[model samples]
Target chain A: MTDTWLTSLITDTPQQGYELAITLSRRGVKYTQPDMDTLKKLRPEYANSAEGLTAASHVIAVNFQTVAAANNYWRG
Target chain B: MTDTWLTSLITDTPQQGYELAITLSRRGVKYTQPDMDTLKKLRPEYANSAEGLTAASHVIAVNFQTVAAANNYWRG
Candidate 1:
């Protein structure tokens, strides 16, 4: 439903964000770790604060979804 | 799981950010609008950048889940 939106949202993150990848794999989900190039463009504010990582966390191409989960999930 | 993380993530936003509320309902999801107090503490970097509103879009307590989805969902 949100093809264009998804395209813009899709991005990568630093290895530091890979912790999210490890967490997701444990929960039975499919995802890829974003490369450094993409992570550089990412706004650090959205990255995970819980793990004390300066780089942006996981990133992907999401279709139509509510912001509720993301809203809370991004917080530290 | 992540009870401490969930508590920290839950927050609020200005009425302008309520647009996310409408999106979630359209998608058959349940969510709440955060009070201004909660939104204030929210780091602006995590707030919805796509929308003109500077306020945080949405906030809720989330259990252990894949960060991949939230990683993409939070952008814009």
Candidate 2:
């Protein structure tokens, strides 16, 4: 939830870059919804349903696509 | 990059849920951009630039927000 979660996306290796991408995604969620209570409350509903889980994955893919594009597909 | 990357988002704990979210995001990118050569090639541009990194984070936040909402903020 801190602004400092990401200083730069420049990584020495692709593995590092990928890890950073995951961190960015996780931190993003924390920043957007700081309220732990709300997050915990809604967990069961989505966790129990296949549709909810798939929807979550779909969003992640969308975000990842943006990151990959920004990173130029991590091509060197 | 397999379709089986995510079968469900239901986790026993918040930690697990968060990890799953990260995996989903990472897998998403792989599924969308399967070309490692392209990803490596584009890494330097965004990796070295501040704007590119920040943009990546911004996209992550957006995606996380969507996931959070879908999970009802994970509120229990």
Model 1 residue A62 lDDT? 17
* Model 2 lDDT tens row, A4-59: 56566565543444445556655666678888998789765644433333344455
Report, for candidate 1, the interface RMSD.
14.0
Cα RMSDs, all models: 15.2, 19.1
Off by over 4 Å in 1: A1-58, A61-76, B1-22, B25-33, B48-76
- Please write out the lDDT profile of model 1 over residues A1-76, one tens digit for every residue: 1211122222233332334333222111111112334333443433434432311122111111222344443444
* lDDT accuracy of residue A4 in candidate 2: 56
Q: Please give me the DockQ of candidate 2 compared with the native complex.
A: 0.07
lDDT of 2 by residue, B1-76 (tens): 3233433334555556556555554454454345666546555655577865665554455545434444445686
Scored by CA lDDT, what does every candidate get?
0.27, 0.52
Interface DockQ of each model:
0.05, 0.07
| Chain A TM-score compared with the true chain A, each model in order | 0.20, 0.64
TM-scores of all models? 0.19, 0.41
- Give a tens-digit lDDT track for model 1, residues B7-75: 222213211122233333223221243455554554243322312111111111011122324334435
lDDT of 2 at A34: 84
